[model samples]
Target: MKRFHVHVVVPRLDESVRFYSSMFGAEPSVLKDDYAKWMLEDPRMNFAISARGGEVGVNHLGFQVDSDEELTALREQVVAGSVVVQDQPGAQCCYANSNKYWAQDPAGVPWETYHTLGGIPMFGADSRESAAPDAGGACCAPVTSIPAVIEKKVGCC
Candidate 1:
């Protein structure tokens, strides 16, 4: 089944954990120093978080595959298109020992199709520092009302 997965970066791990636990009646399955994850079967999503700037929100949105073969097939499919692939076929990400296929749409929004081969020992897995970052260290920067001062025009706002 196709499920929607979201990874959010939160400022306070404890606060978010408590809130989500209370709200969803579910606790995080994987907890790390700066990260937490809740893999829900009912809703069917791999919701995750990381510690940074006390700002809470989504890191990326993507799908998880059942196997490495599926991931490889996705990579080929993505490569067949005009999308630029990164992390290639054999790269570890999301604290999971896995292979992933990454590409950006025309507007530069990342689309990841991944298969988790195994889990990593660490909990707070920061994808920004580990993998792709936009030019500098800007991963999910907010759009400014002042369009004149915007460095990159992603049409987010």
Candidate 2:
């Protein structure tokens, strides 16, 4: 089985948590100082919010699969195309351990396909900041294969 996922960044954690809890009609399944996640079975959506972001808005979108086979299939599908894909096995993030693959839409919207392995005590394993600012600081962080922004130089004639 797969669940549709959406992650967002909020400026105010307390206010956002209250709002989302009320909106979803339930409290988050996982709550941390900087992150909160709601595994909404009723709506079949994995909604998450985080405060450790550079901006306050939609962070990224993703799908969470139930098994390694599903995750493998998902990664294969993404890598089959020309778009670069970064695969992270046993990556720790969001107070959980997961195996996730990441890629970006043509518009450069980061999209992830992951399978949760189990829960962890901390947010993530990264001691350093996320090079991918759009990607939060965690194992969910984009890896080396991630594309760099291209700057087209304009010359005044």
Candidate 3:
């Protein structure tokens, strides 16, 4: 099964953890000095957070690749279609050195291609933003409808 992942940037780790731990009825699987990851089994999502300098909101979204081959295939697909590709391998990101590629969809939301290699503090430890690829745009899709269909179908029955 494919699991959807969402990374968030929170100002206070303790508060965020409290909220999620209550909402999900379990503590995070991994806790770090400036990060936390909840490997929730019910919904099968890797919800994580970091100390990025930003307003409290989504940091990024990602798809888990089972192996190096899948990562390579996804990279090739993006390269053939998209205008930009951001590749960062085994550096520290969200406290893990992961093998991954990054790209922006029509929206500017950054999509990451990664396989965790080891524990680290940051990704691309040496290359500063100046050396990194330009962020294409906003990052990802915008909600086009309100009162979304799923909301209508889902209710306390």
Candidate 4:
């Protein structure tokens, strides 16, 4: 199974959490000082919010898979469609360790497909050798791959 993922950067964490909690009708499954996540089964989505001091809007969109096989298949499909892909095995991001592939759409929105391995204490640490020099301390997608305009508008988790 796969869950749709959406990470958004908000100006205020508390206000956003309250709003989203009311909208979803549930409290966050995981809440931290600067981050919150709701593993929603009703809509089958992983919706997360953060106040990481970047542009205030959608940060990134992704799919979370259940198994390595599903992740590989998703990667293969992306590759088969002629999209360039960046593989980050054991990526530590959003307080979790995951094996993920990052890609961008034609309009420059980043899309990540990953399978979570486990949890971590910190939010994320970008350790990719090819990570952008000016990532602005953001995690998930490689900022170098995103357009300059879009990069400035998205926040890191």
**How accurate locally, in lDDT, is each candidate?**
0.55, 0.72, 0.57, 0.79
Least well predicted 10-residue stretch by lDDT in candidate 4? 128-137
lDDT of 2 by residue, 11-115 (tens): 989999999999999999888888899999987989988887555677778899999999998788777877788777877777777888777788767777888
Report the lDDT of model 4 for residue 103. Answer: 79
Clashes of each: 1, 0, 11, 0
lDDT of 1 by residue, 43-118 (tens): 8887777664433455456777788777677777777875555553433344566565555556444455667767
Backbone clash total, candidate 4: 0
lDDT of 4 by residue, 17-37 (tens): 999999999999999988999
Off-target runs (Cα >4 Å) in candidate 2 are 129-139, 149-157
Our model 3 lands, by Cα RMSD against the true structure, at 10.1
Best candidate according to TM-score: 4
Question: For every model shown, what is its TM-score relative to the native structure?
Answer: 0.69, 0.85, 0.71, 0.87
lDDT of 2 at 23: 98
* Of 1 and 3, the candidate ranking higher by lDDT: 3
Looking at model 3, report the run of 10 residues with the lowest lDDT sum. Answer: 148-157
What range of 10 consecutive residues in model 2 has the weakest lDDT sum? 148-157
1-157 per-residue lDDT for model 3 (tens digits): 4456777777888889889899889998888766678877788888886543444577567776667788788778878885466565553445555676665556556566666666654422434322441321121111122122211111000
State which candidate has the highest lDDT. Answer: 4
- Candidate 4 local Cα displacement, residue 150, angstroms: 7.4
User: TM-score of predicted model 4?
Assistant: 0.87
Model 1: lowest-lDDT 10 consecutive positions: 148-157
TM value for model 1: 0.69
Ranking of candidates on TM-score, top first: 4, 2, 3, 1
